[model samples]
Structures are given as C-alpha cells and as structure tokens.
Target: MDEKLIQRLESAIARLESLSPGSKPPSGTLDAVSAASEPSIVAYDDLLVEYVVKVSLAAEKIGGQVHDITIVLSQAFATQKELLMKIKQTQKPDGGGMTEFLKPLNDKLAQANNMSEGKRSDFFNHLKAASESLSALIWIAYTGKGCGKQKLLLLTSYFPIFNINLASKQQLFALIFSGMSMPIGHVEECWQSAEFYNNKVLVEYKNKDPYHVEWAKALKELYVPGLRDYVKAHYPLGPLWSTTGAVVSAPKSAQPSAPNPPSASLANLASSSSSRPKQGQGMAAVFQEISSKPVTSGLRKVTDDMKTKNRKDRAGFVSSGENEVQKSAPKTAAKTGPPKLELVMGRKWVVENQIGVKDLLIDDCDPKQTVYIFGCKDSVLQIKGKVNNITVDKCTKMGVLFTDVVAAFETVNCSSIEVQCQGAAPTISIDNTAGCQLYLSRESLETSITTAKATEVNVMVPSSDPDADLAEHPLPQQYIHTYQDGNFVTNPVSHSGG
Candidate 1:
C-alpha cells in the first residue's frame, strides 16, 4: 500500500480507538485523539481536494478549447478585413482582375459544422454557431454598407462566446462547492468572479448594445435558470459557504456538543458514496451533461402548460363528433396564428410567431422606427416605407420586401430567406443564415452587403442597359487566407468554367 494510504489507515484505526466508550488519552493528547476520531471529516476534506484538482484539470481543458475557438474567430475576422481590402482594391478604377482564391474557409466551417452535429455538447454547438455567425458577419462586411455602429453590432456576437465561457466556469464552481460545509477562500474567489461577470461585465455589455440584447437575455432565460435547477437536482444540500467567508451551517447552539461515533460516521460516509449519482463519472462527463440540458424555466413551463391545455381542449372537440371538430378547427387556427401589426415602444415594429402567412404587411410610415420579424416560417413580410433598421431572425423560408432602409437590413439565425429592396438601403447584413437571395434595385446598387457563416447567397442587381437581363452574382462563401511578408493575405474562392 502507498505510504499515504497506510498513514490514513493508521489514523483511522486511532480514530476508532479514540471513539470507544470510556476511552481516555494522555493529558496533552486529548485534542489529537478527538481530531483522529473524526475520520469521516478527514475523508470529506480529501474528497473536496480531489474535486478541486479535477476542477483544475477540467478548467485547463475547457480553457484550451475556448482558446482554440478564439483563434478561429480571430482568423475569421482577419480574413474578413483582408477580403474587404481586396474588394476596395478591386473597386478602384485602375485595379486589375482578382485572382482565384482557394476554399480553406469553407473547409474550416465544414469542420466546425461536422463537429457540432448530433449528440454534441453545447461547447461544440456554440463553436458551430460562432463560426456561422462569423461567416454571416463576413458576408455583411463584404457586401453590406455600414459605418462604426454596424461594425460594433457585428462584434456583439462575441458576447455569446463570452457568456458561454463564463457559464462553464460558473458550472464548474457549482459542482465543486455543491455540498461543501466549510467556507473555502478559493471557492469564495470563484463565486465573486461569477457575480462580477454577471453583474458587471454582462450588464454593461447589454446596456451598451441594445441591438443584441437577445444574447444577454439568453443567459438569464437559459443558462441561469438551468443552472439553478441543476444545482437543486444534483446537489440538494445546496452551497454551505457564503460570500462573507462564513460557513452556512447549523448554529453553534444547534450543533451537537459531541461528534458522532467513528464507526457510525464511517458507515454513513460509505453509504452516501455508494448512493451518489454518476459516482464514477469524470468531470468532463459532468460538464457535458450540464451543457446538454438548457432548461428555459418560464418558457418551458408555459409550453408544457399550453401543450396540456391544448390536449385537454381538443379531447372534447374530437370526441364529440366530426362536425364539432370541424367547427373548432378555425378557432384553434385563430388562436395560434400571428397577431395583427403592432408598433412597439413607438420606435420598433414587432412581427413574430407567424407561419405560412403570405400577406403580412407593415405599410405604416416609418422613417424613424425599426422592424423586427422573428420565429416566422414560410412567411412573407412587406414593408412599404423606409425604416431605420430591419432584422429578420430565427425564421425559415421567409421572404421580405421593403421600400428602403435608412441604416441596415439584417437577417440572423435564419434559413432560405429572400429579401427585395425596391428603393435603397445603406447596408444589408446576413449572419448565421443560409440560402439568402437579395434583389437589389438600381438605387440600391451602392448598398454594402456583408455576410458571415452564411451560404448559397446570391444577389440580383439591375443591369445598366434597361433592356438587358438582371445580373446574378453569387457571394463568396469560402476563402483562402495566408500570411506573407508580415501581413496576412486573403482571397475568395473562384471556380473556372467547364
């Protein structure tokens, strides 16, 4: 046996001896005997130390992964800057034809997507989302016209990455201190870091970037609630430490004057160990499990209640008769269908949760107001007047037609979206989107288009000759980035004619 194990065994033996009834020790050895008798306390301390080490190792692994993600993000941004420079150069009067670039970026995005497929953890999913968002930002930067504020909005995507990283660290801390009985100084530091990140950094970011508040809200709607439930479920004993370096346990008056017998304490410890859930699992497994479950407390509860009520409501309609079911169908449809036009906060129009609506119109005058369309599927939205900004998010097979936008037209976390600008817009941004078709009018030709993590995007611009057919141009989705002479070089992928 190892020397430490032997020493522990000896100590345990002494503890058992000291705990015997009527036991007595030498005058100077009383305290030692008392300490030795509490072998379970020592065991608990050792277990905490083991967990601390495990947490450290887990932190290193997570840190490395986070670092890798940052590297990829930096590379993507660098490539975007290079592409912008190239576009600027090519647009110059004396600039020559652009060289054919390779598709290395496509390969990187493909790798990220493949890694995030079925049964992957949140870390991988975040990686995929980040990559896709980056691609969308790249597309917007390349194609959309924008000033500093737009660039800042593009940078806001990084907040999700920050949120996830901090959340992971917080979860690790929760795991280690779940059932701790004493106030640990190091653990206190961890708690303070979490509090600071939540109350200071995240709050400030959210306040500054009103356009991207969804990412911050996600931390509260998903991460925070899920973590609260997870701790409650897995560590029912709760945290026994407080921020003031005080142990949160029974008061001195309530605590027993004498500790439990050594035999009983050891028995209880063994039983608890055997009963612990996933006792043999590693820290990585724990983290993975935690990441996999994102319980949106309020949303989930509402959804569940809605489901139950719907089922109950339908039961009578279906069971009564076929005619009754037919009569109730329209009512159900009316209840679930999209709401009428509503201008929110006097500055924004909100259209959400509609499906297969072919004639959704926002015809009201709006030079100062913005528009947001969300969670709609197979829908068409027509905005008749110029708006300050427009964002289409988390929708599928959606089509948008607008007269003009004063600032930017953006699509995010969407798929198969079609946008038509009849007048003009300063910029069009696509991020974390796929299969977008942009129809640009003559007046909108000067509009800048930017995209990141997006694919299969095509732009149709009117030809100079009125009689000529509209020109179709496919945006580059892949690029090759290289370093030469102390500067990074990037080029879009090109295909030769067969």
Candidate 2:
C-alpha cells in the first residue's frame, strides 16, 4: 500500500527480468537443445546435473531410496507433457531415455543406500533423511503442490478435484523412490500418527483453519527440521528444489494473456477480475526461472532510487557482491507491488561464543542486534540465558518457552512480505518463522535441554486456529491470573539479562 514499497518492488522486478527471464520456448518450439540435431553442441553446463547431485546427496542420507521421490517429482512435469513425451519419444530404441538421464541420480541414491547400517552414523542418517525430504518438497513445488495452475490444469483437465493430489500412496512412491524422496506410504504414515499430528497442530496453531488443520500440522512436522532442513542446506539459493513444490498449486495462468485486444481500462478490469489468472502467471514465471537464480523478491525491494539515494540498500547489496541494480526485480512486482512482510519468532543462536537471543532487547536499538525473523505467521517466544543452544520441544498455551537460564524479552521485526515457494506449493511450512531463519545461518534453537523440568501454560482463549491441538500442562494459577489481567511479569532470573 505504501508508495515507497511500490517503487522498490518495481525496481526488483526489472532486475529479475534482466538477470534471468528464463528460456522462452520457440513459438511452436522443437528440439532446441537435442543432441540428435547437433551432437557436438551440448550446452553441457552441468548445472542441471549439478543440481541433481546436491538433491541426491541430501536425500540418500535417509535410506538412499530416491526412485520414489523422482516418480513424484515427475508428476510436477506432467503438464510439460510435451517435454515429457518428447524425452520419452527420443528414447534410444529402449525405455532408457528419461531413465538414463536420471542414471546419475539413481547411482548416487544407491550409494547412499548401500552404506552399512553400523557405518552410517547418526549425522549420515540425518543428512540422508534431509535429502529425501527435500526431494519430496521439490516434487510438490513442480505441481504447485495441490493448487491448480496451467500445468496442473493441463494434466488434470478431466480430474474432478481440478488437480492431481499427491496424497495418494502410489503417486507418492513414484515421486520419492526414483532417486528422490522415500515413499508416500512412509511419509504419509508419519502424518497419520496421532502424536505427530498433535505436535504438528500445536506448531501450526498460529494460522490456518480447522477443517484440515490436523492434516496440515502433520505435513508441517514432516517437513520442518525433518525434510526441509536438508534441502535448504544442500541446494544453491536459486536452485530448483526451493521453488518446485510451491509452484505446483499456483493460481491459474494469466487467462491466456488476456486475448490481446482490450481497451486500456477494460484490460485492467479483466486482469483484476480474478486472482486465479494473476497468480497462475506469477507462479508459472517463478517455477520456470528458479532453476538458474535465487528468488529475492521477498527478501528486499531495492529501487533504482533507493540504490542511488538510500544508504541502507547500498550498504547491504554493494558490499555483499550482489547486483543491486534496478533491472533485476521480479516482473510480478509490476502488478502486485512490493512484498508484504510479517514479523515472526525465529530460533535462538550464538554469536562470538555468546549465547543470546537473536531478537533481543538492545541496550540502544542497534541494527545488528535487531535480527529479522522471517516466515513465522504467529507471535514468537524469545528466551534468553547463558544457554549455549536450544531445541524447540513444544509451546505452552501462553505460547512461551521456559528455560533454565534467565531469559530476556527481545525486539521484533516485521516486514510487508510476499510468500513465494519457488516452484510449487512449498513442502515446508512457510509459517514457522523460527525454522525459516535457520536457513540463513543467522538463527538456530537455544541450547539443548538437560536437568530441566519443562512445562507449558495453557490459556483458553480464541486463537488463530480454533481446532489446533491442545496439550495439557500445569500452570501457576497466579501467573495465569496476572496474564489475564494484562499484568504478567517475567519470573526472576538466576542470571542477568543478556
């Protein structure tokens, strides 16, 4: 809504176009990169292969079962039926064309799977699990997750649900087992557990509705720390994995480019008439482009004016080797304006051997001390102490985490942000700002808990998601009373606030 934000976003859109507008298909395109026509002219960037390697290495850690993941991922490419069909048609007299293209991935996954059980350390297993999880997430991105878009519509044109759902076991297995994720049976079963669902619901309580809150909670639990963590760690910033799942469920395409013969204001009315077309166009562009570059539209909107006049953009982009020019912004910014941001509670971290909360109360409002929390949709709880690390077990009804150290209240940062999951419906919950910041290496959980009795305080009140899981915990009656009266106080700390 702010004019300044609009200008900044426009600048960002220009930048994206100049940097990576994506490979536009020839008007009735054919074999633009096929070797049959030109054997010696392989593009040979190895970028696509390199991306596959990163995804494979990350997933194979779990069990080296990637075939299932790939099969699910193939679903995302369903709309590219022409592309898929072409690859299939080009098969060398045998059924090994696409399969052969995926050979390296299969071998990598097999190697990850073949490691002796005893020899596979906990770290190794964690890495593998992370990779497999990422593969699934990537698959979801390809198909827009569950939302119907151009490719989804094209593929499921006759399906009643208006889209192909990956909730089924067979489809899930196909995606993961093919040197990608594990299997739908395994991943979905994880969602079916009562305890897992309860814990997941607790975390996702901040936003969303009740209808499928339980299912959504389970999905988030399976994704965060479990699958998303590995993918984020291994892939490049602008790699395909990040955007794959989010793009699948994208809104419909831009209404076939508005029929091309509209008057000025009529065109505006037509485009704004529905969100589906706009979202579809946006999602399509995002999915196609993420393969080569990072999506920073939500990260920051730096305008040409800002780059020239604003000191902050210059300081951040100039010194960091980023191209802070105005021509690289997202094209969607032209329509939607700058991203809207929401402040979130992020994980705790240590800096220079000092165990402290990222969003801590500053002595005098220092920007470095002013850490920005991304992705969280609800209020955050910041606990500080001499504590060396943190592990998020669960939250109380009051939405606070009690720890052994004297924790301090921290400042919060909010941004008007746009949520983009790269290519498909993000496999990861974009709501958990805590975990989201972890990807930046700027935040992490507080110290691990030991010799401490953790407890939660439940507050029975209207919440973001009314049907969210309710965990039982004993709370001090007096503390509850104080909080109700808006006079809550922090318990006395054993140590001074950091």
Candidate 3:
C-alpha cells in the first residue's frame, strides 16, 4: 500500500521485458534458479515468474483473494503478453505478400544510396527485443504449466487472519495429508467494534468466549516458521483467494493494438478493477501458436534452399579445423525426472530430496514425498508423514493424529477428519473442513491454530487433569469428552485453557 513500494514494483515488469524475450524458460529452470543459495536475478526480477504462475493458475481458474497483490500481478501478466506480441510482429514482414521479403533488401540499397544508417540499427533492435521476449515467455509458460498448484492453494487456506477464499467448486480439492504442531499464544491486536451515537467503541473479548480462545490457540500454532517457508524456497507466490476456474481464451487472429499501462496511475496498480484480462488464457493461446501449428509443405523447399546456401557459404569461408580426437568426444544430454527416486506400489520408501509431482495418486501406501495433491475429486489420500509438511484430506474412518513437528495441517471438502494432536507445535487449520470429528486429544493444548473458509471446525481437546473429577467441573457441550466412570460420557465439549 505504500506509494514508494508501488512505484518500485511497477517498474519491475518493464525491466523484466527489456532483459530478454523468447519462449518462456524451461520447466525446472525457474525453480532451480530460485532455490539456489545465490539467485542470478535481482529482487523484482522474481515477480515475473510469480505473475506468470498466477496467470497459469487463472487459466486453470484459481484466484488469489488478496486484492492488492492480484491486481499488481494481473497487470504485469498483461504487460508481458503485449510485449511478446510486439516481438512476434517485428519478426514478420510488414504488409505480407510475395514482395514482403524483398523489402529488407530494397531498404538496404536505399540506405546505402541515401547514407541512412537508422534501418541498420533498427534491424538489430528488433532481434534484441525478440530474443528477450521469447526467452521470458518460455520461462513463464513452463512455470505456469508445471508448478505444483494444488499444494500451493492448500497451504494458504488455513490461516483465518489472511483475507482469502475458494470461490467455486473448481477451486476445491480433495485428498490432503499431514500431521503435528504445537499451540503457543493469544492474539492481542486489540481489535474492537463501534458503539452507538455516543461515539465510543467496545473492546473485543468483553464476553470472553472460551471456544474463541481455543480457536485462536490452534491458529497460532500455524503462524511460526510456517507456510511462508514453503513459499520462500519456491516462487514468491501470492495466496489464491478464489476458485472460479476461468477458461484459457484463445489468442485473436486479427492483430490488436498493444496494451498500454495507465500513464498517471502507477500508484493505482493495487486497485482490483485495474487488472488486465485473463493472462493465462492469452499464454495458452500463444502456446497453441508455438506448439500446435505445423509448417506448410510449400515452406520445405525454401528451408532446404536456405540450409544448402548456409553450408556452401561456410565451406567457402573456412578451412577444416576439427581434430580427430575432439570430434570423437560424446555429447552429453540433460537429465530429467528425480535422479534419486526409487518407486513401487509397496510400502518402505526413503527420500531426502524434494519431489515435484502433479495429479499424484497414492492409496493404501506410506508417506514420504514433498507434496501430494488431488486431481480427481474421488481421489483418496493417506497422510502418514515419514516426510514433512503434508495435508490430510477426506478423513472418513480416518484417525488424524498430530505427532512430531508439523508446521500446519489443513482440511477442506472431505468427509470427516479425526482430531488428535500429540505433537510439539501443531496448527490444525480447518478451511471448509466439514463433516464431524472422529476423535480429539489432550496434547492439543499449547498449539496455535487458525480457521478460515470452512463454516465450522470441530476441535476436541480433552482435559489432562490428574486430581480433578468429572463431577466437580461439568464439560461444555462442544466437547466429545469421556472419563472412567459409570459409562456416562457424551457430546464433544469443555476444552482446557492457558
């Protein structure tokens, strides 16, 4: 929201476009570049990839509900797309016909006679712009298509303090997996509501609901060395707020004028209304142009002629310079897929590196991967954390136990998840986590938890009192409490407090 900050981020897009143009970068390049201990690109240069992924997420119909970040990002995507169009236009002959290619030669002759060097300089400028634009697009497109979107969306949904939501079923996902966090503190922001015409305000927590405190406690568990860690190690992605999966619109056949940014409104980039059209749609359209189009048979003769001419020219210009030993050395190809991965349908697997996967399925199997996500709605997940940072989804007859150091656990659009926190610092984030509880435990105390998106999250934190009897302090109605008595235990209620 700061004026100076807006001006800084606003110039970032232009700097990125000016740097290079070509197809987008390779799929793993962005991640590899970002994750390196030392990054090659400077501060705002990172925003380029993030915006492209946002566009790709939009193409897949995901929206980040945060207003300011999305507005800035959407406009950035538009600006880059327009620049790419110009680069493409510059490569093609103007006024296309049989006479188009001859114009360059004619211009060269005209320049030689008139002693005008502007055409010569202009030729190099176009090449420079195209090279930069094409390269930028390639990196952006690869990230948008290959980034693990499902995990990214799930990670940001749990914290109640953040203003974000899933707008439609398209944004909804099933089959999450995870475990463990420790409850820590209370919120002291001193937020309040207004009174009447007396012009006074009442402080919040005046009524002091115990249930509210419990919720806050659970939420705080997620706040520390949290999802931000996951994001920092990857792209600086903004949280997605909506799920209205918009269709990727095809590119227009007829050329349109390049989109121009508002000259006086660099500060207003935060306005949600100022965002450009769906960029993922435009990127997808461009992708179609690059991938699906086939060269015509008629163009083959022209291509062969160009290659033969190049060969003849090279042979005439240079003598042979290759040594017999150097020529015999084998060329190396790049490696793809996880180099250390070992797989099977059976259990017992160990992996110490990050695993990038999509539409991933693992049923009746043990856990130990970086991220596991749901592609189909009916997909089931088994969240046994032999690895770290997981989401437990669709908890029907499932025993959700929090053990060890689980930074955050979020559940949404699934059946029922059993609640049991026996871990150190666990935050159970319930966003649209419907159904009911199958269990709750005592160790949930001192764990920070937050809730958002979901209508209700059923938490079952039991009393760990040694001397106190059940008859002395009656349990609250929200608890599914039980004790060693005359078989008289019912309803979930009455949790412990700090």
lDDT of each: 0.55, 0.30, 0.32
Q: Compute the lDDT for candidate 1.
A: 0.55
Candidate RMSDs in order: 26.2, 28.6, 28.5
**By TM-score, highest first, what's the ranking?**
1, 3, 2
Instruction: Give the Cα error of residue 32 in candidate 2, in Å.
Output: 12
Clashes of 3: 58
**Candidate 2 residue-wise lDDT, 1-498, digit = tens:** 265346446545544444465745442233432311221111111222323334334333423323344333223223222232233233221112223333333334333333312222212223233223322322221222322132123222222332222232334344333433222422343333223223333332224334233333333444443333333432222122222111222224523354566556966687566423445577676556565556564387767666655655455443533464444555534633432222223323321111122243212221112122222333333433222112222111112232222211221121221211111111122211121121110021221111111122222222246576433222232322236456655553233479
Which is better, 1 or 3, measured by TM-score? 1
- TM-score to native of every candidate shown: 0.38, 0.20, 0.26
Candidate 1, 108: how far from true, in Å? 31
Superposed on all Cα atoms, model 2 deviates from the true structure by an RMSD in Å of 28.6
**In candidate 3, which residue ranges exceed 4 Å CA deviation?**
1-166, 169-387, 395-397, 438-443, 467-498
Mind sharing the TM-score for model 2? 0.20
lDDT of 2 at 290: 60
